[model samples]
Target: MSPASTAAASAGPSARRQASGPAFALTAGVIGLCLAASAVPSPLYRLYAVRWHLPTSTVTLIYATYCLGVLASLLVFGRVSDTWGRRPVVMTGLSGLLVAMGLFGFASGAAWLFAARAVQGLATGIAISASGAALLELRQGRDPATASLANVVASALGVGAGGLLGAVLLQFAPAPLVTPFVVLAVLVAVLLLGMTTVPETVPRVSRSGLRIATPGVPRQIRAPFVVAGLAITCAWSIIGIYLGLAGTLAPALLHTASPLAAGLAILALGGASAVPPLVARALPPAVQIVWGTLALIGGIASMAWSLSADSAVLFVAASVVIGIGVGFAMFGALRTVGAAAPPDGRARVMAAFYIVAYAAISLPAVAAGFVAQRLGAEATFQIFGAGIVAVSVGTLLPALARHRAQHRAQHRA
Candidate 1:
């Protein structure tokens, strides 16, 4: 952290109205809720396809629509919290999410699902961006990285837990399509209410009303911001491909056709991803980024070899390693980026970060879909893994150089 940001963060708590400890915890929970809500809809997509008699192509388009919504939302409203205060924007986003849940619960056709997804994506984008910035502001003590660590770990855990929960409900619910969303609606509604108790983190001086600001990395933060963008791209692209193929891999490469087994793989991925951030909490963000990139490069190689050898054990092992790498890489990247951002514009910077992240999630998965169609799932995994390995190497060199430079400086000091 720069001297300025470190001083500001350290000084923030005493200057602002003190928030309840539980309210700060709830702020973190809101991030988990938004991510979990995003994951829940995936299990129901197949049901949507079956009941609506939609083709796989159309189903993909529907999923893509949600991605578009998230990107657009981040672009437009990413800085609203910066201008209007964090709590109100969070409240507005959660309320929108509640409406999205209602749409899913009551949908009669694919059109309703599309609308529901669009709203859900948009709401999630705004809520999480603001809450992320709020977390930095609400952070206790002296360390500013805790919020970034929480953001990474919560997001990973949320995806896994949500996917499993959705799968279970899909398997057992009397009305599978409606039930999962209804449960989501209940959670969102509760979160919406809970927000009322949280202190607004945006300072009075920062309020300027809502403006439609594009997500941007301000000039002041370009160096770390560029590194963050690269790190996030590598980390999340690996995750995107894994999620896109993991279920298919269960049937094609892992020699398992059962849905439960596929869901377990995703759960394991999330669980593994959550662990490293906690352990690496004391490490500098730059070190974490380089180490995480190294893990990705190795994971990609192993998975490619597994595909060639048709070894399920090797594939599972690769997934676990990559997951840990993701936790460290992303937590570090986010911490670096967030720490560098000027406080008044923190929401917009976070918005920019998430935009890169969501794009990584959507674009790579789409390409993986194309690869799966043309070359078969196994070939898709191999080709994509090799491709990511190459890119990760490119990402790794710069990070390693930067880490070494930092180490040398610390030693000289």
Candidate 2:
């Protein structure tokens, strides 16, 4: 075997030896909390818009900033934990999150929101990479599938919880914006304590220093990789619209100022996202991609109709459909990429996937925001919806074609 293969093979046993069930659970919890914290501001963005007299463009820019931070961290430090060990990187990420929460709690204007979200994005980017790696390593004789599921479930729950918590706090608490961050700070502190008890999975390796590396896929797996990458990008871009604009759109469409209602819209999206993975885990990847894309296109079209007609109920239903679609598509894409990746190069493959996905998440929202500035929310939603449908159809065609060809060849054989 090559030296690189030998190193990875040896490292696997040691990583497994360090696995502990409790530690694995703690790591997963931390990942969930990080994601939840990231979403905490989703429901509150409209409130900021009102309080600060910010425009829709500014609000979208603030949301997009977080994605930029995530992209930067993924590109630069996504694999750093592999060299330096997971514990230190995760702990540092947790610390960054705490600081972000504090910043959010004290923010007096848009500048604070921008800085806090950037920090939160960076922290989450780091924590997720480290924690995900830790979960796979600490699978304790279970298939790595469990780790993947846990990660997705935790992320969806976190997003849902954050939006709901923000809404509740906005409704009940004296200080709407401040209380959510304060509560998040407390939760993160507890997580940090739990993290301290978790053992390191990656042994420290000598390196000159941090270097920027582009993640690469092997030539043999390039076809599936592109398919998965496009699916993930499209899925996340749809999610970006939901996260960045749903709160703003819901209140406008409903013609009400109810924070609770707005929060519920986001919660529906997040909750529905978690459902499909549990329900459709057994489906083949190609089937998952096709059905998921169909659901997404339907949801996006419904949302556009709801916006144009000013039907709040339709909007909420569409959010649920979008969530379900995102869940299935994301899970299937990850599974496809994971299955095709070389054992030793999985991290790099995932890193590249995230880079593409996050770029999709950020760039489209920024463009939509600019468009919203000119055409208004209704027109922007229609355009965005149409665009997503096009991409979904574009991705689905080749995937279905390949699946049909494979089945036909097998039948002939």
Candidate 3:
């Protein structure tokens, strides 16, 4: 065989072995950056509010618009990669992100902020599904457990890092409002270029003559999907509600609006959460699930107390604990969801999972906003805490049942 043919013939098996390394690295990088971009605009919102002489409520509106764009785009094209291939879809998503980042330079008023956020949302919506699908497709091992765990942790880390980094960059960096986006834009451009070399996992297939129907998730996987959805939703909801406005809320409660301090609170949430995934690397997914949920319950409860007592230190500490809970539980569930699903149905199942996850992101924040307006930041957080506890319990029951059943079966075998 010629050299090219020899390479082609050998690529399939070898590629699988090499799969987790590159795919994990790439997905982590891309998703982490995407999360950072989501939060980069957060601290800057205050800057825009002040510079444009805008109300805080207006800032919330701008943020909401971004979520709207994300939700809409996901509904439309979230499953596109299932038929069109991963590379094209991901590249397109990156392009949208690049455009959104560039729009930051010109954002001088509410309209400009709105436009930038909307574009950013669209960019994220595109990238999320494509990148997630790519991660699943790239798994090369006989067992996909490790790769799936990596995917969830990487995504959590990315989100946590982005918020913390955005906070740090805005506070300590020179141009609080302008610099972060610019840096992100440059990095995104480089990533976009790098994505060109990423191997496509999904191949193109004809969409025509197919009976247009919503793809049903496989029956065998539904229970696992629920378990996965619960873990992800609970964790991400905390992130969205807290990180979304912690910069603004922390100062009000603390009697100081120091951007540096507020940003650090957000950073603590990210930093503290990052430790568990690394430590739990060797743990069984079941143990991780239970302990992680307990941590989240504890964290959420502590943060609620912080809010009620008006203590920034307590709030920060609570956030860290919760973030750890988030990392362990969310990653465990995501791994299970991916592992249980068949390969061909992966993208659609994942997309459905995201629909649940993003709903967790969007709806709670909206409720928090309303609560903030009607009661106050403190009251809103207390309500959020109550919701978290309920959700966690609801999710944990099923997971525990499944975990126990699996162990029993193993023992019987």
Candidate 4:
């Protein structure tokens, strides 16, 4: 056979991997597993601090380290799967995570944790990038919006489940820190195995596309991408604050400091995140953005007052509102990006989107940790709340003004 004929013959199989109906859910499960595994350390951060005599700033650094690893991986390996094939990259990343679990389980001090988390983050970034793009390709006959919704819902539930799983193990297991990741490892293994059954989604990969580079946005989507980036940056900043402080807030205001109690806020918030996407299944992205931003601003305001007044009910209520807002806002924004993303460049765009998302989640929380140490959690949270409101209003107002002007012009026509 001619070289051209040989290449064409081989290309047929490498080009497309027809997915079963279950592959869609399974792909989303991979994203969920990545998210859940990342949180396995959250409930244990307190344990690490107490056992190691580490300061709050250092604990926050450990958390930030993971985000840093994720960012670095996204920048470098984000597009590797585009050339390397999603199946191999996903499997490789999962193996890295499995090793990270071992590191976390055997860690002797702060340094081990930093190493473990960094490994965990890098692995997660690659896995999430591959799976996210896989979701787009695996949609089969489904709309891109459905795939986006699945991604949001899985992330929400996975985070809640991870925190709760960690806390439960901590509260009941004989050895807290060691037990959580061991259990998590088993879950990761199962998911890793399940992935083998899912067919590869990438069309064809070549050695030339293997170079390390930053994930890039296509110029066509850059405008909507910025608007989407603003939406998530605003929403996730508030989430980062909540995640950083919820443990302390539970004890200070609610008077419950147990490991189980500490995880409740995250669990509740994460659970609430899944609700909006389900309810707003048919809601337009624009409407979702407006309603979601409004909910976030109101929720944060209510939460700030709840803290000052020591009203646990109000705080819980606000958490629900904020969580729903996260669901809607993130879903709306990501859905917009997904729709705009070119099929071939989907993974790169998604990786760029995550870079923005993780930075928003990481930077603000670290800043809040420092502020809270100096000002106290309640006061720090109030300041945090105000900042979210400011960003939300700044984001919401211009969109609203432009929307109104567009509507009037349409009516005049």
Off by over 4 Å in 4: 1-20, 205-209, 398-413
Per residue, candidate 1 scores C-alpha lDDT tens digits across 1-413 of 54545445432443334533777678888898888887776666666877889876666667777788888999999998988888899999999999999998999988998898899889988898999888887763345677787888888988788877787887778898889888888888888888898877765665889788887888978878888888898888887777667767755666755555556667777888899888878888888888888988887788888878888888788878888888888988888887788766788899999999899888877777766777877788787777777777787777777778878999999
Error of 1 at 141 (Å): 5.7
How well does each candidate superpose onto the true structure, as a TM-score?
Answer: 0.93, 0.89, 0.89, 0.91
lDDT scores in order: 0.80, 0.78, 0.72, 0.81
User: Candidate 1 or 3, higher lDDT?
Assistant: 1
Roughly what TM-score does model 1 have, to 2 decimal places?
A: 0.93
Give the lDDT of residue 296 in candidate 3.
86
Instruction: Sort every candidate by TM-score, greatest first.
Output: 1, 4, 3, 2
Give the range where candidate 4 is weakest over 10 consecutive residues by summed lDDT.
Answer: 1-10
Query: Predictions ranked by lDDT, top down?
Result: 4, 1, 2, 3
Please report the TM-score between candidate 3 and the true structure.
0.89
Native-to-model Cα distance after best TM-score fit, residue 198 in candidate 3, in Å: 1.3
Summarize candidate 2's per-residue lDDT along 306-359 as a digit string, tens digits.
Answer: 887889889989999998888878877776776665544545666777788778
Q: How many residue pairs clash in each candidate?
A: 0, 0, 0, 0
- lDDT for model 1, please: 0.80
